[model samples]
Target: MSTIEKALAKQKTKAPATNDVVTEEKNTESNESVSVNPAPAPTEKFDIFIDNEKLTERGFLHTGGNTTNQQEEFRHIKRKLINNAFGPASKTLNNSNLIMVSSANPNEGKTFVSINLALSIALEQDKTVLLIDADVLRPSIHRELEFENSTGLLDYLCGDTDDVSQIIYSTNLNNLKIMPAGKAHHLTNELLASDRMATLSKELSSRYPDRLVIFDCPPLLGVTETPVLASLVGQAAVVVEESKTKLETIKRATSSLNEDLAIGFVLNKTIKTSKDVYGYYGYGYGRKR
Candidate 1:
């Protein structure tokens, strides 16, 4: 069983700590008839087309998708940084649809941040969010959300599937959907840069004006894909590991982006205390250090 199904099954027996999947069956025993409720199987299963080869399996995105609390923390940072970076770029830019979560290199929490951001937006009572795993070369959102990777953005882009919506997996998060990346293609770069991607973006944006689309892209320095993706996303956020990201590397990454793309930096794994929350700088809380 997929992680979501497992979680749902657990939820059926108890309150889920995060997303809840509830199933109810009504039954009546009579001399001549019996009644019961039907349970629909949760979404599970996936496939991949690698170098013109096809493969299939259960979902991956929802498998280990981040929880709601982690999402909330990301939301806090996203809200704060948008005000700091994009606020002045364009008053209307705050109303952007595309958001790219990236970093100088790998292992800096970019994927975690991006997925959580999408989850955060989806959790919003008034918003609809779609988290697209655009990192085709090494896509992880599929695994995170316990989503089946059989057919997805790559499938749609390659014309393997005509109905793009078929691959969109509805999640426990209300109003939230996911479009994961499929197998690596021979022309991955061309597909990402194609007009088809732009058209898909436009349609998705137009359909859900209040929707937020978060693209979990590859590390800017490690792959050409990120800069290419940056060209498409309206804004980008960089997650810097505390005491690790070099200022020079950050500059190089930022320099590659178009100035029109709003850039914001977040210090992750930051050390803080209660005083820090009370207008006091540094790691101390209310107590003086």
Candidate 2:
């Protein structure tokens, strides 16, 4: 073959190699573009909403109460209930700092309200708060806070350690601490009513008098735990599901409680209508439906 023929053959082979390089570069660029532009976040799902990290943010909208007004309204109710008690919530909280939250039935949003109330209390700068998931049968506050479920009140009561301080866990919130319930046992009520539980509370109250201790106990109806649990704590809060809970049911629940125990009733999943708010705020309460 001539020199030009040989050169032409070489160019033809080199052309295919150059084209392959171009194709590979184009594919790489396309993938880079796809990687850079991700799909928009889905906010519609229930699990996404509940499990979202932003849901736990201090002032994030729609997680607990929707707006500032709603938070203030709930806070006012908390204050009023605290005020109506004999020594007042502030004084009682200052003195002993132990608060127990319970309900008439299981699926009544008791845990939700208890967790939120603890958050509300923790928002206060000066107050240091400890939320104990004393509901041994089914503990959720620990899961909600996304803390380790390894150690807590159960460990302390079972004499896992002499120091209760080992169980206390610090969270993102400045003043708030958590004591999550460990493995569930068969006889929770008896364990709770034992001397160890009482000793733990007494020691905690004495150790951190300025700190608020919120105990999420079992329901009032299903088990005898609430009454037994209430007897141990200084005060109790009953979470009544709004629209679902009847007056008779609430009355029955109140009857179950001893009159001496200062119990405050909280309406959970409460809907606000025109009657609840003036014409100014429109219909919806939290995060615009």
Candidate 3:
């Protein structure tokens, strides 16, 4: 087990047992006492808006709700990721919770996978998730989530916002939050590769060790910024469109990533053939060790 898991196990084992007799006495007294009702606490609201129809149409698991097939597939995928993040394998990772999702080229469904993976991880009882729109050149996460464009990672890195928390927006899904890609800038690549970005990355990983931070980055082979961001994250998942993306492209794209980072490939939009008894279009994972 990892140190974190061992500690949690130990804590659970050492927890105090409930006192049944004391609870019975308190309940007996409460039954004889007068009852007074209290007002309910106000629900926390977020400024962002989510279009359910759009989200459903895009195959995203509904926020704070449930789905069938897609949700199950992502749950299986996220399980392996979480194990790599916090299990015995995580010892070599600098910030195991910080993960980036990208593809070799555009329209490979990287953003779609990124958002789904984040949502699935958020469904876990013990962890929270922060989905960051890292594709500054053509940010699509806000558009995917149906939220208006706002300040985010770039704004904080460029000194436009001193506090990073200001850029993070909470969602109706209690455990999920988002960091939108801020307004477009000419020097977006330079800003992402800057020392400021490195500091912010460290701060994010350390501040909330239990939070899973998923970055929806640009395509690897064609984009300069994705590689830079990949180097900072401890783990990365490359989304490859099955039967469409070439083996050479996958190799070339993954070559840019840091060798120390744990790399995995997600075969997306796979179509079932006559050889397969079950016909389903979904994603599958393969680890690159």
Candidate 4:
């Protein structure tokens, strides 16, 4: 079973913990029903085409395919994420709508999860999701979605672009927009850690209260910027490659994150059983230290 499912089962059989999932969407049971035909939230900018077929062939969640196991699996995970963003968890964390998805190390399926999660959130009846490729050191969202390498997050961060809207593009996928990592620069660390980033984070949070921002960050262990970026977002989903991600490395990676951040671990590439997908997510309250 997925961690969320396991946690729900545990809740049914035992006392609830501070980390249990809260706030089921009132329109429908969040973990059970997938909302269809979400009205597209319009945005002004270049039009981008997301190749659903290409993404399906890549084993990512099929946004266009409504009945697939991939879609259902992500639907379950995104509910918990959305709950933490807009539900009771929002009051506790800063910029609770902004979620950062990273990994202990590279090649652990963080980008894959980030994309699928965004797509799944776009399926929501009353929510929109913005997927930002913040892995400036090694960007992947554009390539994975088959969009042209375009100017994006780094361009704005480095003052190459005066407007953030120019970097965020509207996709054919309803209610989902994207911001690519833009051109890489030697000053990437400085640009990402600068004060301008803080201002942008606030704008993103307050400007769209119903939108969830997903930052696809670089792996946490080796990259200095990931931790720095982590501080800017309220929630962090650390993608842990099953069997390969060591216990010490996962703890070390998360230790660098801010104490106020709502942290969660996503177990990726597991042997899929009848009751679960290849990934599982279990979120918890942040440590006070």
Candidate number of the best lDDT: 4
* lDDT of the structure predicted as candidate 4: 0.76
Poorly placed runs, candidate 2 (over 4 Å): 1-53, 56-67, 81-96, 273-289
The whole-model lDDT of each prediction reads: 0.58, 0.57, 0.73, 0.76
Query: Which 10-residue window of candidate 1 scores lowest in summed lDDT?
Result: 280-289
How does candidate 2 fare on TM-score?
A: 0.68
Superposition TM-score, candidate 1 onto the true structure: 0.68
Report the alpha-carbon TM-score of model 4 versus the true structure: 0.81
> Evaluated with TM-score, which candidate comes out highest?
4
- What 10-residue stretch in candidate 3 is worst by lDDT? 30-39
Candidate 2 global CA lDDT score: 0.57
Q: Per-residue CA lDDT of candidate 3, range 1-289, in tens?
A: 4322443355345334543231111113111111122112213332355544566766676542333556556767788788888888889998888999999999988998998888777656578888999999999998887777777878877889775556777664546778899988989989999998887788777767778889999999877999889878988988888889998888878888888888877878774555332223353444443
Ranking by TM-score: 4, 3, 2, 1
Model 2 lDDT, residue 195, Cα? 89
Tell me each candidate's TM-score. Answer: 0.68, 0.68, 0.78, 0.81
Residue-level lDDT of model 1, residues 6-86, one tens digit each, is 433543443223454444222122111111221233443322211101111221112122232333345566565334333
Question: What tens-digit string does per-residue lDDT give for candidate 2 at 113-147?
Answer: 66766666655534666778988888887566554
How does model 1 fare in lDDT?
0.58
- Which 10 consecutive positions of candidate 4 have the poorest summed lDDT? 15-24
